[model samples]
Target chain A: MSTDDVDAWVESARRGDRTAFTKLFRAHRSLITAVVFRMLGPTGDLEDVVQEVFIQIHKSLPDFRGQAKFTTWAHRVAVNVVLMHRRRARSRPVLVEEEAGGHEPDAGLLPDQDLSRQRRVRAFYRLLDKLSDKKRAVFVLHELEGMAPADIATEVDCPVLTVRTRLFYARRELAQMMHDEPALAGLLAELELAAEGQEQAADADEPARTALGQGRDRRSDP
Target chain B: MTERESHDNIELRPSSEFSARAVRHVVAEVVAAPPPELDWARLETRLLERLESERVTLRSTPPGSLGALFGFVAMAASVVLFVLGAGGPAATRAAATDQLVDVATLPVIDDALGAHSHLAASLAPGSALESGGAARRFVLPGVAAFMLAPGSRVVVRRTGEPYVLELAFGQVTAEVVPRHDTDAIVEAFIVESGGTRVAVHGTVFSVARSPERVEVEVTEGVVAVGPAGYRGDTTGHLLAAPSRATFAARDARLIEVYAPTRATMAAAATPRRDPASLLPAANPLGISRLAEPDAEREVHVRAASRQAPSAPGRDVRAEAVPQPLQGNPGTDATSPPAAGGEPSAAGAVAMSVADARAAMVSCLRRATANAPAASLSVSVSSQITVTLDGDDDVATVQFAPPLRPEIQGQCAGLLFGRAVAGAGSSFVIPFSSR
Candidate 1:
C-alpha cells in the first residue's frame, strides 16, 4: 500500500472502523513484534505486550496527531508497554526460559550455531539488565535497532548530544561487562578470533581493490 | 525502510577494542532473532476481545448514586479520623511513614513477641493457619525474598504501606525490589533492632541482631542506620553497599563501620552528598568479631586506606599481632605476633578494609573519567578478596568468578598498587559504580 492508503486507513481506524483498524494492525505487526521481542529480550511475554501495544495504540489513537510516522508511534507505544511491564513485575528475567529452545525460527540456524547464539544473547541481556532504564532504552534503539543518534534522540525525546553521549558510555560499559563476565570467557575468545580473521580477510582484499582502482598490472616486477 | 529512519546493521559492527569484541557479537545475536511468526489472525482476535471487554467494563461501571454514596461515606470517615486523631502534620507523617517489614529476620517471632505490642500479629507467619513454622521461606513475590534459617520462623505480610520489623534476634539475607522516590508507598521499609533502625530502599543486604547488639551488612544499595527513631535522611550515617555497621542493640549507637570513603565523600559535599552514596561519617572498618576469642574469624574487606584516621581517639594501630586467616589460625585473638613461627605482622601497618575500598572507588572514578571508552555509568558488581601480606604491605587481590586473564591485569592497573590496611586480615570488598 502507498502512503495515501496508509493515511486513509489510519484515519478510518481513528474513527473506529474495524476493517481499517485490522489492516493497520496487520501492517505494523512485524515492526511492533520485532521491537518488543528485542526490548524485552527472549522473555515469553512478547504476545501480551504486543497486544497491550495495539490496545494502547487503539486507546490513544485519537491523540496521535501524525507528528511522527505510524511506525514511530507504534515503536514508542511498544517501548512504553515494555517499561510498564517491567515496572509492574520488577522481575529480572533471564534466558533460562529460552534454554529449552524452539522459540526462535529455525529455518537456517544450525544446532550448534543456535545454542551458541542463544548463550551469547542471554549473557548480553543479563548484563543489559544492570543499566539504568533511560540508558538501556537509548542503547537498544541505537545499537540493536540500528537507529542513528539523531533519530534516537528524536525517539527518546532527548537532545542529540545527550543521545550520543549515552550511546558512547553504554558501549563502554557493555564492553567492560563482556570482559568481566567469567561465563563468557570461551565466547569472548571466539569473538576475538573471528575479529582477527575478518581483519585479515579485509586486509587481503584491500590491495586487489586498490590495484583495480589504479588500473595496475597483476604481475609484480619479480 | 521508512523516510529519515535507516535501520542499518550497526549492531553487527565490531567494537573499537579487542577486549570488548564480545559485546558486538552478543548484541548482534540478540537482535538477530527473526521477528516471530505468530498466527496473526488469532493474535488480533485475542487483542480485540481484550479491548472489547475493557470497554464494556468501563461503560458498565459509570459512577452512579450507589458509588457516590460509598465515596461520600469513606471521605467523611477519613475526615473524622483525621480530625479526631492527633491534629498535627507529625501524626499525619507518622501514619504515612508506617513501614512494612519481613518477619523472617526476627528471632523472637516464635512465641515471645507478645511484649512488643506493635508487632502486628497479621504479619506473624503461620499464625492464623497455625501451620507449623518448620523453616519455610516466605516470599514477598516481586518485592523481596527471604531464606529462613534452620530453626527460624517467619510470616509474610503483604501490605502497601511501609513497616518496622523490630528485630529481637536473628540473621537474615534479603534481596528487595528496587523502589523509586515516587512510589505510592513512599516510606522506606525499616528493620529495627536493639538500638537502631536500618532504613533501606532497593538493595540486597543481610542483618544479624542479638539481644546485646546488631549488625547490618549491605552487599548492594545504600542503607541508613540511626537511633531507634532518628528521622534524619540528612543526619543518619549512610552505609553504602559492600560495607557493614555494628550498633549496640539496646543503645542503637553506631559502634563501627567498614564503609569505604563515605566520610570523605560526605565531608566534601555534606549537603550535596548523594544519600545514595555511603553516609558522610567516617567508616572505621570495625568488626566487633575482631575482638572475639574465635580463631576462625575471616574478615574480608576492600583494601587501600588513605591513612586518614577513621575515628578520633580510636587510633587502634595495626599491632604486630597476626590475625592469621582460618587456615593459619593464630593462638590468642590479641596475643603478640611472637606466639609462633607464623609470619609476624610486625612491619605491616594497621590498615582498615575501607582504605583499600576507598582507593579502588577513587581509582575507578578516575579510570572512567580518563579512559573515554572505559567509562562505567551502570552498576557492575565484582567482589575482590585482598589478603594483607604484611611482607611488603602489598595486598593480593583475588576476583571471584575471575575475569579474563588479560583483563585481570587491567583491573590491577586500576588499583594503582595502593597499600591496603588491616594487616594480616583478609578483606572482601564487593565493588560497584559509585
Candidate 2:
C-alpha cells in the first residue's frame, strides 16, 4: 500500500516487466472498477471495460512521466475509456438492469426500503444518461465521488469554472428529467424538502424575497 | 454529506444539494459494495490469460527467423500429437466416460440435436469465447446451445463433466434442445460462475451474472438454479421463463428479488386491491423478497410467493427505462416502462393504446403475411376489454365472442406484459384487415 512500492512497480512496469504490471493491475483494479461503474452507470460492462483501461494503461505506461499520482491517471484513463464505450453504444440507449455488483444488498435496509432505494438509484441513472459525457464526468466526479470542484478540474484537465458549470447544468438537467419520472417520488420528496427548507431560511430575513436561491449558473463562454 | 447549508453543490438552491445528496443516498449500496470474490477470481484469471497472450505476441520472434521456425515446429508437433491422441485411446475413453471425458476432440452427434438449433460455432475444448459486439452462439452439444450476449466472456470447459460453460460475466441465453425422450433423461447442463452451478431446466432462459448478483430470466421454459449437482425439480428453484429471479449478495448475506411478468399473471393475480390507493403510502410496488440463498423448502413457496403481501406482481425494472413501454419478449415494442404500480408510473413510460394496437396489428401482419394475397376480410368485432384490477397489475379480458383460446392467450400475454398503472382505465381501437 505504500507509495514507494507503487512507484517501484510503475518504474518496472514501464520497462515491460509483466510482474510489475500485474502488481499494478492488482493494486488499481478496485479503483478502476469503481470509477467505471460511477462514470458509465451500472449497465456498463465493468470487467471488460476495466480490462480495457488496464491494457491502455499498460500500453501507455512508458509515456507515464510519474507527474500525477497513478490513481488519478488511472481515473482519467477510465473516464476516457468509458466515454469511448458510450460513443459506440449510441444506438442502444436503453439501460440494462443494474449488474449484480452495481450495488451490494444492504442488510440494514428493510426489503421495501432496499427496493425503494434501488428504484430511486435506477431513476437517477436513467436521468444521468441524458447528459453528455463531459457533463456526466464532472458531475459524477464532483457529486457521486464527492471530489472537490478544484480536484475535478485538475482530473478532467479543465478549469474550475468549467467543472462547476458542467456540474450545475448536469444537476439542472437531472432535476428536469427526474420531474418526468413519478417513480422518483422518493428523491423528489427530498428535493422538495431541501428546496422548501432553503426557501424558509432565505425568507426569514428577506421577507419580501420569495424566489428560491438559484445556484449561480456559471456558464463559461465558448 | 455536508449539511444542507454548507453543501458543496447547494450554495443557495436546494436542487443542487438535492441532486447530490439524493443520488448519493440511493447509490450508497453500490458505493459501499465490495467486489465479490468469485467475480474477482474470474476477472483475475482472464486478465492473466490475456496478459500472457499479449506477452507471447509481443515477444514472438520475427517471421522467417530461425527462432520463428523453431516455434512453428513446436506448434506443429503439438497439433500432430493432439490429433493422434484425440483419435487413439483418448477417443475410446471419451465414449465410455459419463460426460467426464473430453468431448472437444470427439465428434458431436449433431443429428441428435434439434434441426436448425445447432451451435453457430463448434468450439474446441478450453476455448475461451468473448462476444465483442454481437451475440455469439455456443453449442453445449447434447444439452443445448446458448447465445452469448454482446460483451460477455465465457470459457467452455471440456475436460471432466464437460457439459459446462463458465460465464465469467454478462448475459447468456440458453435454449434447451427438444428431445423425443427428453422426459426420460434430465436435460441438464451447467452455466457455472460465482461458485454456483445453474443446472439448465427444460426450455430457454438467460442467466446474467455480475460480481455480486446473478439474475435468471425465463423467456421460454423453466430453469433450475441451485448448488452444483442439485436436482432442479426436487432441490433447486424452478424459475419459470416468464419470471426473473435476482440473487444479490452483500459479503456473505444474500438478498433475493423475484419479479414475475404478465406471462405468469393469471398465476400471479392479486385480489382487487388498487395500487393507485397504495401509491401515496410507502412504495408497495417497490418491494423485494429477502431470503437466504441456500434455503430449500418446497415448490409451494415459489407458487405462494406469486401472491399476497409480497406479491411478485410488479416489476421494479420498469422505472429504469425512461422511454415508452417497448417490446419485451411478450411485449413487442421498443418502449420504456415505468415501474408498473401507480398510474403515474405507467403514465411515465406506458406506450399508448394506439401504439399497443399497432404492435398487435404488426404481429397479425407477420402471421398473415404469407396468407393469400387476394383480399381476405377479417374483422375482430368483439370488444376486448383489458381489465386491470387493484393490485392486479395484470390485464385480463372476458373474450367477448369467437376469439380462439390460443388468440386469447396471445392477446392476454400482450396486455399483461403492459401491466401499467391505473386499474379502472379503458381504451378502444378498431382495425380491419381486408
lDDT of 1 at B182: 40
Local accuracy by lDDT, each model: 0.46, 0.46
lDDT for each residue of candidate 1 in B69-101, tens digit (9 for 90 to 100) = 000000000000000000112211111222435
- lDDT by residue for model 2 over B195-272, one digit each (tens)? 234433333333443335555443333343443311222123333333455443111111342334332332222222
- The clash tally of candidate 2 reads 11
Docking class of 2: incorrect
What tens digits encode model 2's per-residue C-alpha lDDT throughout A1-222?
Answer: 889999999999888788888888889887888777766665536667677788778878887888999888887787777765564333211222436443453447778876776566666777777677788878777666777887778877899888877877776677666667665756768677888999888879574442223222233323
TM-score for all predictions?
0.40, 0.40
Best by the DockQ measure? 1
> TM-score for chain A of every candidate model?
0.74, 0.72
Q: Over the stretch A146-211, how does candidate 1's per-residue lDDT look in tens digits?
A: 767786777678898787667667777777677656656667787678988999999999999998
